[model samples]
Target: MRLRVEFTTEPFDLDEAPAHALAAREVIETAELDAVDVGPFGNTAEGSTDGVLEAVDTLLRKSLEAGATRISLQVSVIGDGNGEGGR
Candidate 1:
């Protein structure tokens, strides 16, 4: 299964993202996934389902340890035509 995961860690200034966001981003980048997207509102990573799940778990724990007050997540299963998703 292929998956895309999106997440955001909060308690950060809009002008400058805090350490939690940075830590989550770092986890995603180092996950060796197929693709990744980092945005103002959140970050997303694409890869095998198991890999994405592992990375998401690591991201959440590390971000919280870095001081995230809240976290939001979305996950999607990629397919050829039909759309399927989760959050």
Candidate 2:
């Protein structure tokens, strides 16, 4: 099954979102993620459901650590589970 996962956290400035995205990209470095869509960050991103979820979760935590005033994020994903490894 595929999941269209989404969530809203605190609000963050657009300029700072890229930094968060860059950091979040590292999450894929040691995982089983098939790919990383090298675009979008901050309040948004697009990728496999699992990868997007993991990155959002990590970015939220990191944003808090970085003293981000408000880091709100939402994700809309689409996938076909029967088409495994197709993300």
Candidate 3:
């Protein structure tokens, strides 16, 4: 199964990347996911179910430790030819 995870850690800053964002990106990159992108609003990563979940878990914990006051997350299961998609 393919998983896509997107998250934002606040308080958001336009001039500099937040510590939580940096921490989350490190975890995602270390996991070697198929794709990872960091944007102004949040970050997104795609990988196998296990890989994505593990990365998400670690990212969440690390983000909090990095002083994130709040975090918003969205997770989805990519299309797999069986009508299970975007959930």
Which TM-score value belongs to model 2?
0.46
Which residue pairs show backbone clashes in model 3? none
Per-candidate Cα RMSD to the true structure, in Å, reads 3.4, 5.2, 2.2
Per-residue alpha-carbon lDDT of candidate 2 for residues 1-87, written as tens digits (9 for 90 to 100): 344333333443455554444444455344344433434432233455676566667766764664545645444445565665433
Q: Give a tens-digit lDDT track for model 3, residues 1-87.
A: 788998989998889998887897789889958778878887888888888899889988999999899989998989553666765
Ranking by TM-score: 3, 1, 2
**TM-score-better candidate, 1 vs 2:** 1
- Which candidate has the highest lDDT of all? 3
Which portions of model 3 miss their true places by more than 4 Å? 81-87
TM-score of each: 0.84, 0.46, 0.86
lDDT of 1 by residue, 1-87 (tens): 678888888986788879998899889988968779888787888888788999988998999999999999988888422354443
Candidates' lDDT values, in order?
0.84, 0.48, 0.86
Model 1, 10: alpha-carbon shift in Å? 0.5
The number of the candidate with the highest TM-score is: 3
